[model samples]
Target: MGGTVVRQEILGGVAVLTLSNPPVNALGHGLRAAIDSALEAALANDSVRAVVLAAEGKVFVGGADISEFGTPPRAPLLPDVLDRLDGAGKPVVAAIYGAALGGGLELALACHARVVGPKAKLGLPEVKLGLIPGAGGTQRLPRLVGPESAFAMMLSGEPVDAKKAVAMGLADALETGDLVEAARTHALKLAEGGAPVRVRDRGERLDPATRAGFETKATEAVKKAPGQPNVAALADVVRAGFDLPFEEAVKTERTRFLALVDDPRSKALRYAFFAERETARVPGLSKETPRREIASAAVIGAGTMGGGIALCFANAGIPVTVIETEQEALDRGLARMRATYASSVKRGSLSEAAMEERLGRITGAVGLDNAAQADIVVEAAFEEMGIKETIFSALSRIAKPGAILATNTSYLDIDRIADATDRPGDVLGLHFFSPANVMRLVEVVRAARTAPDALATGNDLARRLGKLPVTVGVCFGFVGNRMLARRSAAGERLLLAGALPHEVDAAVTEFGFRMGPFAMSDLAGLDIGWRTRKATGGKAPVADALCEAGRLGQKTGKGFYLYPEGARTGSRDPEVEALIERTSAEHGITRRSFSPDEIVARLMLPMVNEGARILEEGIAARPGDIDTIWLNGYNWPAWRGGPMHWADSLGLAAVAADLDRFAEESGDETLRPAPLLARLAQEGKRFSDWGGR
Candidate 1:
């Protein structure tokens, strides 16, 4: 009690050490030292045959103090402290009531037994920071939970609930009532010849077949990981645990973990992790900025993106008004929402009543003024600038005076739309992903004159909507789409040089994207880009011609791939290839075959170079802002970190050189290297090296 630790005596043979950190109970230096002293004191007491480890907060250990990241690490990490506890001759039972994450889970794993409350969650999420578990987690976890389970937990960094934890053998049992009393009783039973000696001696409970299956899964992961190193390294660490003795495996795990602590990917990922925390910290955005409490939200468009956005607000339990100009469109959005809810129900993730309750909160309307009193009116209208401007003008007049006027304009200038309103400061861009509700990213674009309170409200709104909000300066396309434009242009050139859409998309997807550009384009519908081009009066070339030919993508039954009914992806369309060839000849472009190496260089170099442009232009606050946008919004693979992280791994000099070669080969000046890229390349530095503040 003297130093943030509550120590108590139970019955004959049980003593308790409860960590008393506030909030999430992040295990810090003082807490660790107290835990060490408490363990030692309990070990010395003759009456204490077993100990119950618990926490006196909303959660158990939420993990290491994230605030200490990128600084000199503290002594005695959770793994070391837990090892000391395990070294004691008596049994240690960990009683977990809330989330036990990262180092928290490692500590629980070190205990001889574990009891978790029904609402408890456990996970090893070090990989999310581009790091493997440093504290014997890789070794001890595989021994207890088997290889496949451990591998997935480490790689994906997702938490498992109490039921799932018990089923997976991560938890010994569920603590039904009092966690402390249950833990103390379990400890006493173990002390009086009840449970096993320690986790180290419980190899008999592990199945050899499980190990074999895990090895196979690891092999599959390696096969999936082409150029990436971390996924394969995770698989290797899991393999070491299965092949080597326990102590030897622990040593191997430590070596791999330490080596990756300062790896380029880790540094970038850790930087991104901290930067995300700092995003909510604006100098002017203190507690003083008056925030309007928005109890309900509304979406004016009921298309794919609109329905998803509506779902996001509804999922957060905010009543949403989904307004469309047509009753038919409103009905379609309702049907899509029902299908989405039904899918969740089918996955056993939703109850029928719960789904109905969520749906019940959403009201479908067919008039622009239907949700006139909404706290926030989000217009996800057609990409046409005129349509969006019209919507904004009407929303400003129809919606309540203080209501936030948000435009879901992806690439169009947000400032121009804000000009349509009398109160420009209250208008901003809330660019969500294609299916706004499903994707986790929500880019909050700040126009030059946007009021500080409005910006704060936008950020708060995104949080309330259950999305990650990244601030980006107003520009054509904002941050995420702006970088994507560069990637798209590079890919288009690759197609002109005889690299098929499949080839380019496959190269990037194989490099770690969930889907290649063409596949995504097909899924999003090619007509989207065609419409954007027509509105902007820009030459779409291939996209315009495809749309003119009625090749509007999956809905039209033909796109880059020709689809049959019920098939999400289409087979290769030779007709599209012929179209490409015809366009190339019409433009007087000499066709040449491009290798995958050439394809990658052509596609990625421009995006990397444009990212530098974005950073210098202040469209994105930091390199990590871009990373977070792509990671959440664009489905960039987490294991590869992000584009900027990948750029750091590629080395700035090498990327600049690749851009030079691309410009020379493609004969296009947009491939000309960015000044920032050139400077960073000359200095042999990473984008992360240029830190903020």
Candidate 2:
């Protein structure tokens, strides 16, 4: 198994070609060559009547070699190897364990039959990376499992467990015992029937019933992704499998796959896929860095965010104590959490017993000292500085010496909060986004005096709790929200200059954001920002007046738009339009029509400018970190990449020019292109060109 990707063993007249690559046995060029060599040896041997394809690692074959992407195709491609298996003189069965995904599943599908281990997962999840299956997945999958099930699997891009694989006929059998032995027996049985039949030649599942509603399903698939064309491309390829000859359909799929390889959306998704891994690489920290043990945890406060934080620990199977100042508030928070869990159970997302088990991990108590028992305590109190300072001061006095102290602050200064505690090394920011249990992005803010071990613990625990940890330097709003503030400011400018909330939201949503800044603000409540603005001596004329009129948001059934009869979707209200025009007049601003493209540019480009500032200030390590944060925390479209990547794709010079023009037009110096952005534009460089400081 040393440096060998495939090991061939002739046992009981069946050649077992075992993939020996550790970790995920990705089908690199060498591995594909080794597989071909093994297959040749098996077919050449007179004693070998059948073949069992297996692997030594957890996964049989993970997928393609991502490192080989954007490069020339090597010799003996996966499709070639799969084609050899399809027309092999001897029967071949794939023994899949752990996972057989992407090209790996395509390889398995090419075999005469498949034996899946109990722990096996099978899928063709290429659509997730904004590409369809290139190696005959769209063709063979439908032939084996029928078009409807195959389309559902490919479009959803979710893996099916072993049980479901057998049920769907994707897997020939579920092997509870040794997978390779089962595969050997299955291959021998298939060989007894004569030469193996290729999956592409099978028409058993191509009945008219499978084709019913296929047109509607294909349309639905295209509708799933509005702005993105990859899904539509995938749907077209899958439809070609149903309508055209197998050979012709495969050619169609290949053409589509090759085209998608150069698609901006696919490239962005691929970049994001690598970027998430890059975020784990800390600059000053090494793999040997000590991480403080995080066993039991505590969350200070039982509000919406605080309860969500507690749920995160509970879901991770870590017992967490939720501390509240009063029993009533604690009870309310716990009840709300239970209701949320109950809804998940009702939707069949979680079992009743599992909900109870998760709930049992969360304990509610009414005191600051209750946090002292936990190894790490997160203060998810109000976003106000005084409240955070008071909690930290109390935490410093009550918490154990080695325990980590974290603040779940979105925008406040973490260093100032850490200054309240004597052990600033143990104090860091764990900025969990709203609905913390659900959001994956957790900003691990390193304070001025944060110890390496303490920072390491935050990153470690975040991963353990199934979160994307983007380590950021202490700054106002850190990376995501700091950039969000710039966008919010720009959005406000758009509203004051004649663009309505609905117009701005429409522009953003069309640009691939799930919701626009105005709609998101309304949903989050106009009062939240109004209170913050009032508290900070800041003014937002239109929003402040809306809040003053008690038009909070969807809860109040009115805000920037009308949500009549408690509707979630809002309709534009003439009163709000009048309010915006009146506000523009009051502010001595001229009203002008804004095209959707201009509205999108006005809002998004400023965030790109702020991202440049963030990178220059070392607030974020790299462009990817900002993208990962925004992608997870802010509903930034995965296809478009992040704000910085979007800017780089737009070209730095174009962005810099646009920002300069916007600044000049608006007479807003703050809207001017950042120094780093201006310099990068002048130097003909992209943000991705930076070495992340």
Top candidate, metric lDDT: 2
Worst 10 residues of 2 by lDDT: 1-10
Model 1: worst 10 consecutive residues (lDDT sum): 1-10
| Every candidate's lDDT | 0.81, 0.89
**TM-scores for the candidates:** 0.85, 0.94
What is candidate 1's lDDT per residue for 252-306, written digit by digit as tens? Answer: 8777776777576566567667667766765457878988778888898898889
Per-residue CA lDDT of model 2 for 471-553, tens digit only, reads: 99998789987888778778888899989888899988889988888778879998888877776687777888999999999
Candidate 1 stretches with Cα past 4 Å from truth are 1-42, 45-60, 64-81, 95-99, 113-121, 134-156, 160-189, 194-196, 208-245, 248-252, 259-272, 275-278, 564-575, 657-670, 691-693
Residue pairs with colliding backbones in model 1 are 308-437, 411-477
Number of the top TM-score candidate: 2
- For model 1 the local lDDT of residue 446 reads 87
RMSD of every candidate to native, in Å, equals 4.2, 2.5
* Residue 384 of model 2, lDDT score: 92
